[model samples]
Target: MVIEYSGIVVRSVLTDKREKFYDSKGIGCYMFRIDEAEVVDATMHGSAARFINHSCEPNCYSRVIHVEGHKRIVIFALRRILRGEELTYDYKFPIEEPAAKLPCNCGARRCRRFLN
Candidate 1:
């Protein structure tokens, strides 16, 4: 494990409201969804893991693991990453309508062109 994506866990229904609140204040939202009803709000208390960008072909991957009785998000190396290599992972966003798709510039040979 490289680092934990630390943050407060919140109900998924609150994501939209919180994101909008952040947007109104020009605060960038940084969150990792855990499931249909849970998400980690990292905009205010995240680690460097939250700053890692997306890649079509990534060297790291994010996972949710249970420890004791708590859930945590962890970033793990996907392979033998060379020194100084940037850490990244596929966002794996849910598919959306074309008009709402986010453009991807990951530049991988097999790039999907869109993130969703």
Candidate 2:
């Protein structure tokens, strides 16, 4: 499906793992792994797929929904987002291992002291 606003059109995928690859512009892509309240054959392992990245204070948040009988992650805006703003969410919530933490370079004024 396509999520459009202004002239920007983002392609959303309904594949397993909610995989997001870098676009031609180097921006992370967005997709919906579930459709019509049904979860795709996606099982989100604690890999890069779970690392949506973080912000000092993010403008979006991730919500897990149990559709049909599977779990899927959905990102929603926390406030009114401007047209050119980069969408980000807290990745720490999904990672359970200490090794999952990495250095963040988001450059937010209140960025976490460390990338964990």
Candidate 3:
């Protein structure tokens, strides 16, 4: 499926962990803020989002924006994203605000201890 935002067509993703409302596929999940929908909380799952592998030095970054009074998660291309490239973002927030670690197979030169 495709998610239409403004005039942009973003991809949609569905995986096994939709019950949690969001799940990271070693890649990332795009989320829509709670205010976007009545039934969901501050976050809703992006079912068509892709599974881009993780990298310590990532080429993409996730940003939360307020759209139509709703907060939405968008993956921005920090660098050039080639066709067929898997989109990835840094799961680690910051050194002081660290998230739990998950097993990582992302094989980057500077792979983190977890995928988060």
Q: Pick the candidate with the highest TM-score.
A: 1
lDDT of 3 by residue, 4-114 (tens): 212122223322344244444343333332222321222233233434446777778765667797655566788777887777667553244254546667678888766
Give the range where candidate 3 is weakest over 10 consecutive residues by summed lDDT: 1-10
**Candidate 1 residue spans exceeding 4 A from truth:** none
Candidate 2 steric clashes: 0
Name the candidate, 1 or 2, with the larger lDDT value. Answer: 1
RMSD of each: 0.9, 9.6, 8.3
lDDT of 1 by residue, 1-116 (tens): 88899888999999999999999999999999988889999999878888999999999998999999888889999999888998999989999887999999999888989988
Deviating ranges (above 4 Å) for candidate 2: 1-53, 93-101
Residue 105 deviation, candidate 3, in Å?
Answer: 1.3
Q: Flag clash pairs in model 1.
A: none
Rank by TM-score, descending?
1, 3, 2
Which has the higher TM-score value, candidate number 2 or candidate number 3?
3
Q: List the global CA lDDT of all models.
A: 0.92, 0.49, 0.49
